[model samples]
Target: MLMRKTAALLLLSLPLALARPMSTLAQAPVQYNVAFPNAVHHEARVTATFRELPAGPLQVRMARSSPGRYALHEFAKNVYDVAATDSRGRALTITRPDPSGWAVTGHDGTVTFTYTLFGDRTDGTYAGIDARHAHLNIPATLAYAEGLEQRPAQVQFAGLPAAWTVATQLQPDAAGTTYSAPNLQYLMDSPTSLGEQQVRTWQEGGRTIELKVLHEGTPAELDAYAAQTQKIVREAAAVFGGMPAFDFGRYTFVANYLPQTSSDGMEHRNSTSLTSRRPLRGPGAIDNLGTVAHEFFHAWNVERLRPQDLEPFNFSQANISSNLWFAEGFTQYYGELVLRRAGIYPTDTEYCQEALTGLVNAMMLSPGAARFSPVQMSQQAPFVDAAAAIDPNNRTNTYLSYYYIGAANALALDLELRARFKTDLDTYMRALWQQFGSQQQNYAPARPYTTPDLQRVLGEVARDTAFAGQFFRQHIYGHQQPDYPALLAPAGLLVRPARPNKASLATRLSFNAADSTATLGTTTSGSPLYVAGLDREDVVLRFDGQRLVGSKAFEELLSTHRPGDVVQLEVRTRTGLQTVPVTLTEEPALEVVTYEAAGRPISKAQKKFRAAWLSSKVR
Candidate 1:
C-alpha cells in the first residue's frame, strides 16, 4: 500500500491543503490501512482501497483546504507514484487530476493505491523537520476526490509504542486503537503526530487537566514549556466555568519549529497546531506562549460554540461572515485575561497594554481593511480569484485586513461590554458552548445566518440593543476603520501611537514626497505608519483625512508630523465608527534586549527562526 504526498503553502496565517494546483474535481471515499514503520526514524505508509466505486468515469481530487484553515490550497502536486488497480488485483489507468489531484477510473469494484507520505513532524504537508520528528497533515498533503470528504474512513497503524498516549478527536473504541470520525471535516481537523509526547497530568479542584507537548528538544526545556502552558490553560479554563467544557486529556498540542513562516497556531476542537521558532530571546519570543492561550480559548469559543458559517462549513466555497471578531477577537482578549488572572502577566497594565497594542496596530492600518467588505470578502477569500485579488503594489492586503482587524475589535468589545453592561460581556460564548460543547446542539449546519439570528446572540450581552446590526453594518462590513481610542477610554486604557527611536533602527526606512514613510523588509518596525493615525488599520485619507497625493506622497506627508503635537488623527472603532482624537507620542526607542525567564523561551525547532530573523542568539 502507498501513502500519498502533496504540495501546499499557507498564506497569511491560513493553512490550506493543496496537492495539485489547478484541478476541479471532488474527492471520493477511500478506506485505508496505514502504519508507521519507524520510531527512531518516523515514516508513514498508506494502502487505501476504494470499494463501491461510483459508475460514471469518476476522478479523485484532494482538498485544497485543511480542517480549520479556510484558504484553498492545492494538495496533489507533491503526491508521487500514484497507481490504481481493481478488486481482482488488476491494474487500472491513472490520469492528471487537475491543478491539484489525480484520476483513477475503472469498473465499480474495489480499487487500491499505495503511497508513502514523508512524515517528518512539521506543520505543513509532508513536513519532516528532521529524521526523528514528523507531522502528518494528511488532508493538505494527500488527495482523494471532491466528493469523498464525507465518506466513512478508518485507519490502523503500528510503528511506535502502544503505551504512548494518543490524541485525536475521532470516535474511539474501547481498545482505543480503532478510531472513527463522523465525516471528513473531522479527519482533516485531526492532525496526527507520533512520538513520545511530553505529558504532565494533574487533577485540581476535582477536574483533570493535562499538558501534552510533542517535540525532540531537551527534556528540561520541554518540561518547563509543558508546565507553564499547563498553568496558562488551567487558569484560562477556570475563567469560563472552572475547567474546559470538554476533556483535556485527549487534547494534543503539535508545536512545529518552522521560522520565517506563519509562525502561528491553528485551534481545533481538541487540539492545536502551533508553528514557531523555539528558544525565543525575550518578550517578543513569548508571543508563541500567548498564542497558545489564544487558541486554547478557542476550544470553547470558536471550535465548540461556533457561528452559523462554521457550524457546517461549505468545503466547496467560502462561508461568508462578519462576526469573526466575536469568534476570534474575543478569544484573543480572554487569552491575556486568563494569563493575567493566573498571575503570569504580573501586572494589570501589561495585560491592558497587550490588548491595546493589538488595538493600536489596527488603527494604524486602517482603510487597508476597508477594501474587503464583510459580505463580499468573507464569502470570496478562500476562493478569491488570485489575479484580481492582488493590489496595485503587488502586495496582498489580506495579511492585516480581515483576521487582525476583526480580532482587535473583539478585544475592545469584550472590555467595553464589561464596562458598559457591568456584567461578564457575552454569555453567547458560554451559551453556545453549552449547546454545542455540552449538549452537542447545532445552530447553523452548512447554512447562511439571517441578520436577526446574529442580533439575537448579541442581545445576550448588548447594553445598546438596537445598535448591534448598526455596529455590524458600519464598523464590521463597512469601509470605516475601527475606533479604538474611545473604546479604550471608557475602560481607562489608552492607545497612544509610538514614535520611532533616537538611534535604534533595523530595516531601511524612507519617506515619500508627501511625508509617508515605508519600512522596507520582511518585517517592518512601525507597520505602514498606522495608515494615517486611523489606528491599526485606519485608512489614510489625507495628512489628516484628506486624499493624498499618492502612495509616495503619503510617505512624505508622514515625515512632517512632530512629536507631542496634536497632528490630525481619525479612525473607525466598534463604539460608533466615528473619527476621534489620538495624541501621538515620540516613538519610544527599542533595542535588542533579552531577559531570563524562569523557564525555557522556545523549543529547538523554533530557535532556527530567530537565528534567521533576529539580532540576538536564541540560547
Candidate 2:
C-alpha cells in the first residue's frame, strides 16, 4: 500500500504530458506469416497491413534475432526480396527500413515483405524437430521488425499442410487460430508458434487457462502438464498483488530436443521455448514446468514493467546496459517460488537448501569463475550480444546466455531483501506497481534503476530500510558472489556435506536386484567400468567365463587405476554380448573449491558399498 502511494506521489511529480504515451496503444494493426512448408529453407512473410498511413519511413524491426536474448538483431540479412505491395497486389515503391525491413510511402494496405530464414533447422537449430515443428521467438526467425512495429492486422499463414497447427496467445478460432487484442502493443506482447501442438487446459478460480506445448513428445507424458502450469502461473501472479496480465492471455511453451541440444531455457513475452528431446512427465519431465513458470512470470516484470534500455528498443544499435538481473533473474527466482507455493517444495528450508546446494556446486565446479560474473557481465553474454544488430550476425560461438545466472541472483537477492524486511517479498512488487505499473507501460521507464530508485521503493515498504541499497552495491553490481550461507541461514537451510550426484557401474553391478544383470543407460568417459573397456552396456562377466556378481565388485576393480589408463574387460556378444577393449580418456574436472568438501571418509563397514556406487562424472 505504501509503495502504491509512493508511486502515486512520484507520478504526481512527473509532467502530465509524458504519462500520456504510456497508456496509449495507439498504433495501426499488422499481420504476419511464418510459413515453412519445409523445415529446410524456411521463410517468414511479415505483412504490416496498416489500417492508416503515417509519415516517416514506415520501418519495421526485430529485437535481436531471438527471444530470451536481448540484442538488436538486424533480421534483414535473413530477409530477401524486400518489396512492398498495395491492395491490388501491385508493387508499391518501397525502400529499406535501415536494411531490415521495407519502408513504404503512401496508402496503408497489405504491404508484405518475404524474408528467407535458414533457421538451422536440423543440425543447426537443434531445439526442435524441423522447421515444420518449430516455435516462433524474437520475431526474427518468423517475422521481423519490432522498433517501428505495428499491431499485426491479420497475421495469416499459407503454404502449410493441414496437419500443422498454429498456437498463439490470441483469441481462439474454430476455422483457424485467431487472436484479437485491444491494440498493436498487445499483439506485439503475444507470440505464436505453428507446428504440431499438444494443448492442456484447466479451470482455476472460475477461469480457464491453457498450456500449448509445441514439440515431438508423447501427449500422455504431458497429462499432468496443465496442472503443473496452473500452479506456477497462479502462484506467481499471487505474488505481485494478484495477476496483472490479462487473465485470458495465452503463454506458449516451446520444446525442441533434438538428439543433442543444450539443457537450458529462453524466455519470451507471452511464451517460452525449452530444450527437451525427452518426455514432459515423471520426475525429469517437470523441467518443462520450471521454464514455463520462468517465462510466465515475465509477463508482469519484463513484458509490462521493464528496463529503460529495453524499452523503445533500437534496432540499428545495441543496448549496452545491465538490468536483465532484475527482469530475467527475478522471474527465475519466482519460477521456483511457484514450485514452493504449489506445495511441490515441502518447506522454505528445503527450497533454500536445494538452491544453495546447486549454487555451491556450480561455484566449486566452475573453472571460469574468475573470468565471468554471470550476474554483472551477462549483458555482454552471447544471448544479449548484438549479433542481430551487428554485421557478421553469426552466433555460432559466443554461447553465454545470462538469464539463468542473473535469475539465480534475483532469487537470492529477493529472498535476502524479504528477510531484511521480515515480510513477504511480494510487497516489493506491489511497490513497483504502485510506482510505475500503469503509467510506465512502455519498456523504457525502467532503464537504469539508480540508488534513489531503490531507496524510494524500499523506503516505502520498510521504513529506513537501506539494506537493499547496500546489498545491491556489495553483491550485485560487481563480480562478487552473493553471501549464500549468510543470506539463506535466516531461511533455515542447513548445508549438509553435499552428496555427489554421480552413478557407477560397480554400484550397478552390486545392487540387490540380482546378479548377472546390467543397467541400460548412456556411456561416459569418467566411469570406472567404462575405463575397464565398458562400452555403454557391455555386460560384465567373470574371467575364464566366470560371472561378476555386482556393481560392488565392479568398483573394487576400478579404484586401481588413474584416469587415462586402459583396462581390459571380458563381456558378452550379439549371440549374447562380448568384451570390447577400449582405452580410458581423461575428462575435464572442475576443481572442488566451491562444492562443499566431502564429509569425513565413509565408514569401513560402508566403504565396500560406497566406493562402487557413485561415479564422479555423469551429467
Candidate 3:
C-alpha cells in the first residue's frame, strides 16, 4: 500500500539530557527519536535512548512476531544502519547476537541505539510511513531491550505537519504528540494513526467511544458510518449484558479508510486498527461495518477473555493459542450476527447468505475439513495466518482457516444448544464475560482458559456435562464434519448444493489469461484430477486436443462431455509436457445455499423454532 510523504516522524521517548547521572537514569523514560529525511526511499531513521542499562551484553531486538498475530513477521528485516552509542556520543561495541537481535556492550551505563526501518505495508500488524502520516504498530517500528520490557515508555512524533493529529489508545501527555505506555505489552497492542483525521465520539454504557477516521468522505458520510458503528457496539454490548470496564474508561477505533491501505481489522486491548479500501456509505459499507463488529467483539473475547496459552505475549516469537477457534472464530461468528440483530442486515436471507458464504460452506466444501479438526486447524495458524510472504505452499487442500472452521463449530453448537436445552451461545458467552472480562480482570499470561475450561463452561450452560463432552469429542477434537443439514434442520433451514448433479472438470484451476494456460490449484481428493496424478502448479496446455483458452473455455469443454467420459489432457509440469489420459467425472457439488426448505411448508412449531433461534431474546 502507498502512503503520503510529509515531515512528521515518530520518536519513542521523552527528551532527556545526555549528561544525566547513571543512578538517576533508572527513573529516566526511554525515548525514541525518528526522522524521515529520506521519504522517497520509504525509510525512517529511528533512535532509542535508554536511561540506564544492565551490566554485560545488552540485547536490543526487534520483534519477530507479536500478539494477536500467529505468524512470524521478522520485523528486523526492515531494520538497517544499526548503531549504538553511550550518553557521551562515543560508539559502543555492537555485535549481532542473533538474526533478530543486536548486542551492545561496553556502554557507559546509558545507551542510545539507532536504525532505519523501511515500512510500506499499512495494516493492523505492520508500519506504513510516507511523509504525510505515519501509521505505527509499535512492534513493527520500535526495538526494545531484552530485559527492559517491564519499564514505562514514552514516545513523541517529531516534526509532524501542523494540521495533522494523532489517534491511539496510549495515554497522551500535555501535548498530544507525545504518548506513554505502562509497559511493552501495552505499547505493542497500541496502534497509532496520524494525519488529517476526522474524530467522532459518543458514550455507550458509561464508556466513551472514539472513532478516528482517515478517509475520503464528508462529515455526513462519516456520521452515517459512525452511526452504524455505534449500532454494532451497542448490539455487541447487549450480548455480554453490559460494557467492559474499558481501559481508561474509553475505547478507540483507529480507522484508515484510504484507497491505498490494505483491507484489515485487528483487535487490541482497548482499541482496534481498522483499514479498508472502501469509503463509508457505499456498497462496501456493510462489509466494512462487519469488520468493525468483529473487532469490537474481540475486546471481550481475545483482548481480555483470552486463552491462558496466549497471555503474556512474546515479542521475540510467534504467539499461538489453542483457542483461536473461539478467540477469532467466535468473534467472527458474532461480528456477523451482531449486524443482523442491529437492523443493518434486516433480513434472514441476508444473514443466511453470510453464514453459508463465510462459515458453513467453507467447512462443508473444503477437502481439508475432513482431514483436520478445528483444534488442529488452530495449531496451523502460525503457518497459514498471515505468515511472511516468501514461498508457495499448497494450503487449499491441506488447510482450512481456523476462523471458518471455528465459526462453523460455534454455529453447530449454538444450534445444538437451542435444540436440546433451549439455551444459546449467548448465554454461554455472557457467563464467560462476567467471569473473565468484567471487573477489569484482564488476562495475565498465566491465567488463560483452556479447552477443558471451554468445555466446562459449555456443560454448565447446558446443565449437562455429558452432552458437552460428546460435542467436543465429535466436533472439536474428532475429524467428523459437523452434520450441517441435520443441525440446521432444527432451525427450519436447509443446506443443499448450488447445482444438483452438475458435470464438472473435477479439478480447481487458476487461469492465466496472458498465456491462456490453466494452472492447477486444489484438486478434490479422489477426484479425476488427483487420481490421474495431476499435481498443483501443473499447467494445462490442451484439453481434448484443443488449446486451453481460459477458465470459461475449460468449463465449456466440461459441459460438452458427460460423466464417465475419457479425455486427453496435455499437461506441463516441471518434468515436461505429457498427455495424460484422464476420465471425466461428476464432481461432488459442494457449493451450497441455505433457505427455509421449500415445499415443506413451515409448520407453527417450525416457525417458532426459527423465530426463537434468530431473535435476540433468550429462550
Q: What is the TM-score of each candidate against the true structure?
A: 0.68, 0.63, 0.92
Question: TM-score: which is higher, 2 or 3?
Answer: 3
Q: Which candidate should be chosen as best, given lDDT against the real structure?
A: 3
TM-score of 3: 0.92
Ten consecutive residues with minimal summed lDDT in candidate 2?
4-13
**lDDT at position 505, candidate 1:** 21
lDDT of 2 by residue, 119-188 (tens): 4432112223244454444344434444434333344444455555666554444555344443334344
Tens digits of lDDT, candidate 1, 444-483? 2223344356556566557466666666667566645556
Cα-lDDT of candidate 1? 0.51
Q: Could you say which candidate leads in TM-score?
A: 3
Regions more than 4 Å wrong, model 3: 1-26, 174-177, 389-392, 439-446, 512-516, 562-566, 573-600, 616-619
Best-to-worst lDDT order: 3, 1, 2
Of models 2 and 3, which has the larger lDDT? 3
Cα lDDT tens digits, model 3, 354-416, are: 655457668876888888888888999888778866777767677788888888888888888
Q: Candidate 1, 183: how far from true, in Å?
A: 2.4
